[model samples]
Target: MDFTLSGQQRDRCASVLARTQTAFPAGPGDHQPTASASAYTRAEWSRLADLGLLGASVPTAEGGGGLGALDTALVFESAGRGCADTGILFAAAAHLFSCGMPILDFAPPDTRKRLLPRMCSGELIAGNAMTEPESGSDVARLTVTARRVADGFLLSGTKSFVSNGPVADVFVTYATTDPQAGHLGVTAFVVERGAPGLAVGQPLDKMGLLSCPAAAVTFDDCFVPDEQVLGAPGQGGAIFQHSMRWERSCLFAVYLGVQQRLLDRCVEHVRQRRQSGKRLAEFQSVSNRVVDMKLRLESGRLLLYRACDALDRDDPDASLWVSLSKLAVSEAAVASSLDAMQLFGGRGCLREEGIEAAVRDALPTTVFSGTSEIQRQLIARSIGL
Candidate 1:
């Protein structure tokens, strides 16, 4: 019931924000820069690992911080506040919530002992491969298939828009084992990058979050041992849903941080910048827009925390709150970014100001982690409409 952070939690949040700001300082020249070689550098990944952020949600036994869902959201929010490059944060969230959590929860102990530590240590990276060309939001339409083999399975399919795919050491993907069984027939597997017949396509040219590399992954009879199978057969649906709930509830906190940062910048700008010999803050229209931004930021944070709390308590209605939080935070991010851009006048349109980049980054928030439309549909369905 209490939303206030404990002193220890406050210290963790401050430490993470300070470290992230130090590591990824924002500058005028730093706007919209593309990753030339790798999606993210090993050194950067190591820094996050050093901060214990990469493993914040992981159990201590698995070489992680063992933080719960609410604490994990705090970590992400702080990171988002400090890190100018939301791409890396986005990539890390995908790794933890989408790929790593499912494996941590559903994988066999042997598999966990083998991979989780490395993943937590930043020695290895993981990617989630669920979306396909024909299947984005709809899991039942997936075309990927996995055939049983002697000691393992043969997977044949292509997964599109896979975040961190280009550099991932392992992948948690889903494929149909019994097409007739529909969603129940789908199975999940943890496939290594070195698995035979696994091919990663060139990174997709993206509109924003350029530092987070996404690619299409093709599995041509890829071999996965029985030990790599996540849970039992026909369990992929549940596993995917479990990971997605974590993602939808916790990962969206990053946007909350981003919006906070944007709000801070806009507030400072309005106070300092003058128009017609008056501070921008003195203008009713300008001040009202800033007020709206503040309102959205605070409101979104409430929904986000509520969802995260529900997740921590294992509430049955957690999905509803998660969807509400996701939809609110995402749309708020985009709206606040636009308000920031407009308030900045011509400077916002310029790349050097970083405002335009924020818009581009915010644009996709509604699309990923389940689209805003999908979230609305889920919310309505939950309400018995």
Candidate 2:
């Protein structure tokens, strides 16, 4: 498979990078979250939509850019490189891959017709609600229940750590329909924000990615019509897995962009900064660290591109490739960020330098979108472990 991007793809990447630079020109200080500013404002979100980033992967008929997995990954990487606020990028990825993808792929035509345009236009924001307080990775153990009702279903449960929860207009959530069926009992539904008995709790304070507001969402016998159901009953597991494959394959490309930007800064710093009458770049130790950062970035990028290729081809080994990609990129991001901090010295420790914030942002990459450990487990299973 040719991993080389076509001329058109290169142009798209350049366009996205230019747009992100114009849309978010602020440095790390201006981008930092305040008590009153925890997430992207409506205007900023709209700006992103205008850039065609919010709908990069959705079908063109649905008012989206109709980008495939590889193209989508390239768009995200460009955004990461241009935008200093990783939190907003993270929020966008969750909204697109984790929430919008399932509805686009599995929801009824009517539902898709109604939601996709609004979602693509930035008129509505969506969230994924799968993780409960009790169930993180284990979908079968989710306590959320969806009981069949006369009209549809009545959902009751609490979802913890919902990205974009505080501002989401709708959510693609999962609930257990038959407790006896294990994972098969789980079902997916698109629940609106103002549905009766549906409540969004206060935003949760996070150590990083604060610009992406997360909160607990509770459904107290919330009613949902059959039309809102995504895929058939008992297909929630597969649907969720499908969305995650998209996420793991493409979402981490954002980190690649982040790493690239960080590496650029480190190279500039080492070349300009000096010690003992010689530039930092002249020191083998300092130069080696920068080399390692470059190594990780390029290597991780290949794995990411390969994963995206696997997804595009619908390869049976897609999961293995995705897990490998996610693990490599996430780990590389954290390691490169730390190295950047060290290279920056005392300045890096300061919030203003943005180096520390980079570390904080990179730290969570390994945890979200399934942990590094879970990816390893999937990889092990693929190898007959």
Candidate 3:
């Protein structure tokens, strides 16, 4: 399979990087300020909208770029590289790929028509609330419940670790309509922010990606109209699975960009920073670590690109490939960040150099999307374990 990007794709990537670079926030000194109070500030939000990033994957008929999976990977990877502020990048991915894509794909006509246009215009922010307090990777076990009413459904329970939660205008949420049916019971819904009983908690002060605010969302007898149900009552598990395919396959590309950025900065640092009357790059240990970072970077790119290509091609192994790619890229991100920290030594630990931030950002790779442990189990099962 060929992995080279097309001319148009390269141009698209370059263009995206340019806009993202201009708008992303830069931390002054040691303290990193989030681009805004929430995951997105209006200024950067408009810039992304103006750049056509908000709708990169929407169909042209929907007033979007109408790009495919590979195009999404390309655009976002560039966005990740252009902005060292991975928080904004993460917020962008959660909105477009994780939350928006599913709504566009599975939501009813009225629901999509009401939300997607504004979402693409950056007038609306969406969050996917999948992980519950009790169940993270074990998505089938979430306890949130949805009961049908004359008007629609009354949803009750809490969703935890919701990325983009604090600032979301709408949520693509899941709740079980029938606890006995297991995965089949979970139903997906498009719950607007002002719905009667939906309340968003204060943004969690996370260890990394401070700009991308996360929070717990509570639905205490919240009413969702019938039109807002995505797909059907029993199909939420399927919808969530579909969204995960997009999230794991595309969102992790941000890490690919981060790893590349880390490598670039490290190379520049070692070449310029001196030790023992010689450049840091002259030392075998430092040089070898750089080599290892390169190795992980290329491997990650290959895995992600291959998974993307497989999805575009509709290959039978697409799911397996996506899981593998997510695993590889996420793990590589953590590994490469460590190497960057090691190479920078004292400065790596210092918040001012931005090296420590990368490490903190990369640390979450193992936990989100799918944990490294979950990925391994899924990969094994996919290959006939």
What are the per-residue Cα lDDT tens digits for candidate 1 across 124-173?
A: 98899999999999987679999999988999999998999999999999
Candidate 3 lDDT over 1-385, as tens digits, reads 5667789888889888887777664555323543344455877777777777778888877767788888888888998887887876788788888778888898888788878888888898888899888999888877889998997999999998888898889899999899899999889999999999999998898889887889999999999999999998899988888888888978899888888888998999999999989999999989999999999889888888888888889898998989999998998999999999898888788777777888888899889888989989989999899
Q: Give the winner by TM-score: 2 or 3.
A: 2
Q: Give the per-residue lDDT of model 2 (tens digit) for 190-284.
A: 99998999999999988888789999999999999999999999999999999999898778999999999999999999999999999999999
Q: Clashing pairs in model 1?
A: none
As for candidate 2, its clashing pairs are none
Mark the regions of model 2 whose C-alpha exceeds 4 Å error after superposition.
28-31, 34-36
- Root-mean-square deviation per candidate: 1.3, 1.3, 1.8
lDDT of 2 at 356: 83
Q: Summing lDDT over every window of 10 consecutive residues in candidate 2, give the lowest-scoring window.
A: 29-38
Sliding window of 10 residues with minimal summed lDDT for model 1: 29-38
